[model samples]
Target: MPDSHLHEPRDSTLVDLHQDLPDAARLKRLGVVIAVGAVIIAGAGIAWRSHSVGTETVTAHAAAVSDVAVVHPAPAAPTDDLVLPGQVQAWNSAAINARTNGYVRSWLADIGDHVHTGQPLAVLDAPEVDQALAQAEADYQTALANRSLAATTATRWTQLLTQDAVSKQETDEKQGDLAAKTAVANAALANVKRLRAMQGFERVLAPFDGVVTARAAQIGALVVTGNLNAQPLFTVADVHRMRIYVHVPQTYSAMLHPGIVASLDLPEYPGRTFSATLVRTAGAVDVQSGSVLVELQSDNTDRQLKPGAFTQVHFHAAGSVGTMTLPGTAILYGNDGPSIAVVGADGKVTVRLVKIIRDDGNVVRVTGALNTGDAVIDSPPDAIHNGQNVHVTQVLPAVTAAKAGARAK
Candidate 1:
């Protein structure tokens, strides 16, 4: 019933549709392939994301680590010059005080005057002492006259007793009176001698060959005898030699002994050094200061150095075998005390408590649990803690040039 061309076209269209249609078995195979591909892509994506996250975590951890510079502890020199503050004093100094009550009439010697032993420094006018001496002398003379009269009387009485004109008791009494008068005369003479001795103190004399460093007495000044609080009339000091008093630390006290020579540096005399010899020591440590007092003698024949001058004393002290040196920057002061941060082999920080024996400007001498091989952190961070991880960025020399310079100074 249809046209032949139309029927042919419809049959062709049906054939095309049948060819385009896929079988169930083929579709099943395609579905399995697609599923396998999706699983592979998802696994790859997950693995890539995990790798990126791991890389970021590693970078962040590395950034959180602290970088520090480390240094090794250096062995101290076998012998080093230990410099300490000291005071220069006179070899023989004296504070001249009055021995007798008097008024200062005149001063023969004053400050900066060189005097000889037994030389008069001042003259005291003691009217009371003079009056007393005159009285004592008059008393002595009266006693002598009494003794003479008594002797004459006793001789006459003895002669009369021989003649039997006076009784024996009367003669004995006369002899006793003569003896008593003689005793009184002796006592008066003793009093006169004591007064004369006291009068000799009117002249203030020098005790030794020295220079008058101070003069407190003035003309018309009243001086009291045996006054503990009275100012000295004069201060004399022997400057031919000087004595240096240095308070050496107890740790270095053992190095100080008699005959050891030291050098002194005074601020007044810059760039000049004076030689001194150790003469004595306190032989005991001062508990309050933890130091030992040492005496050193130096020649001042030139009289350039003065008493009571501050100086720097350089003592050649032998270092202990266990002593160690480190840069001051390595020291860490905390609430506990002075300490040092040390880096271990495992890149961990360990704080060691230390005691500072000496602190130079840039260097320090210390003793503690640290060893020569320890790696100490220089300029440690304030927040640095014990047992913390750190990255050592650099290793510094144990003794830097700056530290050496400081030690030399």
Candidate 2:
């Protein structure tokens, strides 16, 4: 046996080394497992972060969209009555002005007095006209005397010429003098006639059978003739019938004819309607107002209706088929003219151009590519445009909106 202790130590050392080798292999496998777990956790964290960022971006975009309320267009009523404000006037009105210049001596007719045709309304004390007439008569008589003397002289001269006592030239001269005197007499007579006519105008007369509605002439008031700025002496109006002037819109101008009958409502007589007959129309639409002026006549035998009174006119206006009406606020005015914002089922906006038929402040009548069930934005934003995405906050019914518009009216 060669060194038993040394051999034992070497064998122990070898066994220990073998056991450590297995431990080292286990440790290496453990490190590999740890590294794989770390890589998987990092990947999960990064994916979760990216998903959270995407969700935030989507929420921000949704919050930025505009919200709006929508309403549906309502069907226009058929056979709708058109009511408009009208003015009441007299059938025949005249402003009685003085024909000649004079002082008003006396007034025979006062305001509210009914006078007949050619009735004297006032008498004027025109001293100047009287003096002129007297002078004209005196001049006319002087001219007549001169004409008589010239005629006698001419007859005497003709006799002398026949006997050769005077030359033919003398006889011709006498005849020419007579002719000149006759012309002067005729001129004076014409002047006298003119002055007499002026004298006849001393009494202001009524032009027709009517009631005196105004009296501007007072006793001793001096009147002037041919003056445009002068006020009339009296205002006479025929009250047997009344005239009503109504401005019918161009849309309803076709329905207004001469034989059409309408009703009038006066605030003075509540609940009472006066029957009126359409007498005439302007025949053309007024450019400024886009309406036709119509004249209607109403019998005022009882004299209940007065001139210059405000009244309401009502007509049975014919309605057009397939007409649509919407709230006036829904109309959008842009460079392309009038349009409306329509929302589709996908919440996308499609701006459709429209033609405005009428606007009654609360409601508007239009014709365009629109339906009864299509949603229209009410009071759309100015920036709202075509292809815009909008979130609808409320949807109003067509009937309810119509009733509301009617109430607003």
Candidate 3:
């Protein structure tokens, strides 16, 4: 029975070995398992790749829609005015000084005193001039007496010659002596006249109708005649009108004429504008300043405007070129000179070349191949290029181009 059992186990082990060995079904099953695993891995890889590609596409789309600020160019006027610095001055000013040596006796006028032409401003006590006048008078009288005696002697000599009481030579000598005495008398008379004229200067008089802007005259102040080193007695200014001197740039020189209208603005009188007429201009340009000196006159009958005041002169100029103004931030300075970033209606960025006319800190005046309807990018990015897509984050309010032009006027 034990032998029978061993034989049966052996037979079973053989059957099991055959089953575990490579069989068609088993090999087919193993191949099927490997094929299923490869299919599943390929499907997973395809899914992961699709997901990564989708994420990348979304990220790229997000980057393409960049937010940018956009603004519309301000409407520009056909004509723009120019404002320039000017110097205000008196129409006519003079420094009054002593014409003759004297001491200040009394001043009839002080600073801020308005007087007429030939009006006495001060009285000067000129002792030397008085003495000289007196001496000149005495000399003139003596010369007159001598001239009279010479005339009488000359007449008598001629009469004597006719009577043959004296020689012709002696008569001629007497006539010559009389001529010499007459010339001396004439010189003395001239000296007397000169002294008298100089004495008249002792009364300091106004040269014209004007106001005394300054006075240095004091009681008993000694003044030398024609002394350039001496301080002036008074400063007389014709305040009936005021003169403004402006150095206009050569670019605008052609627009200026003798009658061009200009307005004056002063710091002292804010909001009060004075109308001015162009009086004259230095036709030639100054090499040093590269500008023309223009003179303008304004009526100051009320004496409101004063001399030597800082002023702003506004010149109305007509613009012939199509110019536009934009905010300063819209301008972009690049290697290709000044340029601006413009946005197309389709939201494409396009850089344009521009010519700048003026810069007023926050505003810029530009002229180029641009239209009023074009949108300009404010504070453009450094890497911005032409034909780049942009997404406008905000549309700034329309800036008034007329304000800058108005200020020019």
RMSD vs true structure, all candidates: 9.7, 8.0, 9.8
**Relative to the true structure, how large is the alpha-carbon lDDT of every model?**
0.89, 0.87, 0.85
Model 3: colliding residue pairs = none
Q: What lDDT score goes with residue 409 in model 2?
A: 66
Runs off by more than 4 Å, candidate 1: 1-71, 151-176, 226-229, 321-323, 327-396, 400-409
TM-score list, all predictions:
0.66, 0.72, 0.65
lDDT per residue as tens, model 1, 1-409: 8778655545433334334456886677668989999999999999999999999999988976789999898877777787899999998999999888999999999899999999999999999989999999999999999999999999999999999999999999999999999999999999999988889999999999999999998999999988888999999999999999999888677667888778999998899999998899999999999999999999998998899999999987666677788888999898998999999999989988998766665788888998888999999998888888899989998874346776777
Model 2 lDDT tens row, 1-409: 6877655645433334234467778688678989999999999999999999999999988976679999898877765566789999988899988878899999999999999999999998888989999999999999999999999999999999889999999999999999999999999999999989888899989988889999998999999899999999999999899999999988667656897778899988999999988899999989999999999999999998888899999876555566688888899999999899999999899999987766666677777899898999999987888888899999976643347557976
Best by lDDT: 1
Q: Which ten residues in a row have the lowest lDDT in candidate 1?
A: 9-18
Candidate 3 wrong stretches, greater than 4 Å = 1-76, 251-255, 321-409
Ranking of all candidate structures by their lDDT, best first? 1, 2, 3
Question: What TM-score quantifies how close candidate 1 is to the native fold?
Answer: 0.66
lDDT comparing candidate 2 with the true structure:
0.87
